[model samples]
Target: MQVISVNVGRPRPNPGKGADLTGIDKRPVNGAVAVVVPGPKGTGEVGLVGDRVYDVKHHGGTDQAVYAYAREDLDSWEADLGRSLGSGAFGENLTTAGVDVNRALIGERWQIGPDVVLEVSSPRIPCGTFQGWLQQQGWIKRFTRAALPGAYLRVIVPGQLRATDPIQILHRPDHEVTVELAFRALTLEPELLPQLSAAEALPEEARKRALRRSSTG
Candidate 1:
C-alpha cells in the first residue's frame, strides 16, 4: 500500500465554468490552502470533512485527499498495464499499489504513515468542476454509471502525507457498498439505499446528498 499522489486544491469559486475550468491550471487557484481558521460553520475554520475547504454546504471536508488503486489495479501496473498518473480514471488523492479501493467499501478504515488514520466516508461524487476539467458533458454521470468508483475519506488522525507513503488496510466494512456502489447509489441507483444505509460509515451529508439525486430505477 502506497500513496500514488498527494493533492489538494484551493476552493476558489471557479470563476470560469463549463469549459474554462478544463485548462491545466495549477490548483490553489485562490493562491493558498484554506487554513483552519475559526468560522461560522463548524468548530474550526478548517472544515475537517475531506482534505479541502469549501463553503461547508458545498464542500464539507477539510481533507480533499483520497486514496485509490486497489490491489487488482496495482498488479496491472506492475505488469506495465496500469494507467498513468493524472489520468481521469485515477481520481484519488493517494493511489495505493495493491489495494482494490473500490472493494474497500465506504466506512472502511486505513492506516497510512505513522499517524494518519481515516474512515472511508463515501465515493468522490462527480461535480461540475470535474466535467469542466475534462471538458466532457455528463462525465460525472458516466462515472457513476460505471460504479466501483473512487472513495472519499475523513481524516481521523491528520498527519503530514506525501506521495509514496505506504498504506495499510485496517478494516473493510462487512457490507457490499463500495465506492463504486456508493457512486452509482448517489448518482444512479436509488434502490440501493438499504445497502448504503448498512455501510454505516458514510458521512451524514453525503448520504443525504445521494438520497436527493435522480432515481429512475
Candidate 2:
C-alpha cells in the first residue's frame, strides 16, 4: 500500500463538544512530516509533528499516536454520505491507499517509507467530539454499527513520512485480534474481550482493558 496523504492538525475552536479547542480540523500537508513516539495521554503531544488533540483524557498517546484511515473507506463513506471527504477529514494522520486498515491485525507492523515502523495498537473509537465535528446526528452509533473504525498506531521506528511513500508489512503477529475485532471487543461485544488475549503484542492499556472486561464477564 501507499500513503496517499500526510495530514496534520492545529488546535482550533470547536463548539460541538462544548470545547473551545479541538484538533479535529486536520488538513493534508504537502511535504514529508516527522513521525515520533510521544509520551502518554494528557501530555499534549501526538505522533505527527504539529498535530494536537484537545481531549487529553481520551486522546494523544503512544498507543493511539498515529491514526490511519483507508482512502477506500473514505470513498465508501463519501458515496454513502453523498459528499466528498478529503484526506484527514476524519482527523487521521495518515490517509492510506489500497489498505484494509480496519482489517489490520493488532500488533501488525508496517514499514512506512524506509525507516518508520508503525505498530497497530488499537481501533479509533468514535466519540462525542468526532460526532460533533461531523455534525451528523446518530453518527457515533452509525460509525460503531458500520464496524469500519480505522486503525490507531504506535511508532515502532521513528522516521520521516511523506505522501505516496511505500508501505511494507514488516511483521504480522499470529493472532485473531484485528483492528475490527478490537473495536468490537471495546465497543459492541464485551464477550470478545477474552479473545483479545491472543494478541499479546497489544498495548498494555488496551490489553489490560480487555483482560479486565473478560475477567468481569
Candidate 3:
C-alpha cells in the first residue's frame, strides 16, 4: 500500500462543539512532514508537525497521534453521499491506498517509506465537530453504524513521510480485535467488548471500558 496524501490541519473556528477551534479542516500538503511522538493527551499535540486536535479531552495523544483512512473507503462514502470526498476530508492525516484500515488489528505495525514506523492503537470515533464539518445531520450515528471509523496510530519510530510513501505491514498482533471490531464494541455492540481484551495494544481507556463491560456482564 501507499500513502496517497499527507494532510495537515489549519485551525478554524468550531461552532459545532464547545471547543473554540477545530483542526478538522486538514488539507493535503506537499513534501515531507516530520512525524514524532506527541507529548500527551489534552495538549492538542499530534504526530504530524503542524496538525493538532482542539478537542483535547477526546482526541490527540500517543495512542492517537496519527489518523489514517483508506482511499477506498472515501470512495465508498463519495458514492453514498453523492459528493466527492478528497484526501483529509475525514480529518485523517494519512489518506492511504490498498490498505484495509478498518480490518487492521490493534498493535499492527506499519513501516511507512524507509523510516517511520507506526502502530495501530485505536479507532477514530465520530464527534460533533465532524458532523458540523460535513454539515450532515445525524452523521455521528451514521458513521458509528457504518463501523468504518478508520484507524488511529501511534508513532513507533519517528522520521519523515510524505505523499506517495510506500506502506508495508511490518507486523500484525495475534489477536481478533480489529479496528472495525473495536469500533463496534465501543459503539453499538457491548457484547463484543469482552473480546477486546485480547488486543493488549488497545488504548488504556478503551481497555478499561472493555474490562468494565466484561465485569458487569
Listed in order, each prediction's TM-score against the native is 0.67, 0.96, 0.98
- List the lowest-lDDT window of 10 residues for candidate 1: 23-32
- Per-candidate local distance difference test: 0.53, 0.89, 0.95
Name the TM-score of candidate 1: 0.67
- Give stretches of model 3 more than 4 Å off: none
> Which ranges in model 2 have alpha carbons more than 4 Å from their true place?
none
Highest TM-score against the true fold, candidate: 3
lDDT string, candidate 1, 1-217, tens digits: 7765554443334433432322222221112222222233332233222344333444334433343445445344335423343422343445456667776777788887666787777666666665555455676666566564556666666655555667888887677878777776666676666557666677776665545542322
User: Which parts of model 1 are misplaced by more than 4 Å?
Assistant: 10-56, 62-91, 206-217
| Candidate 2: tens digits of C-alpha lDDT, residues 113-132 | 98999999889999887898
Q: Tell me the TM-score of model 3.
A: 0.98
After aligning candidate 1 to the native by TM-score, how far in Å is the CA of 139 from where it should be? 1.6
Ranking by lDDT: 3, 2, 1
Model 2 RMSD in Å is 1.3
Against the true structure, candidate 3 has what lDDT?
0.95
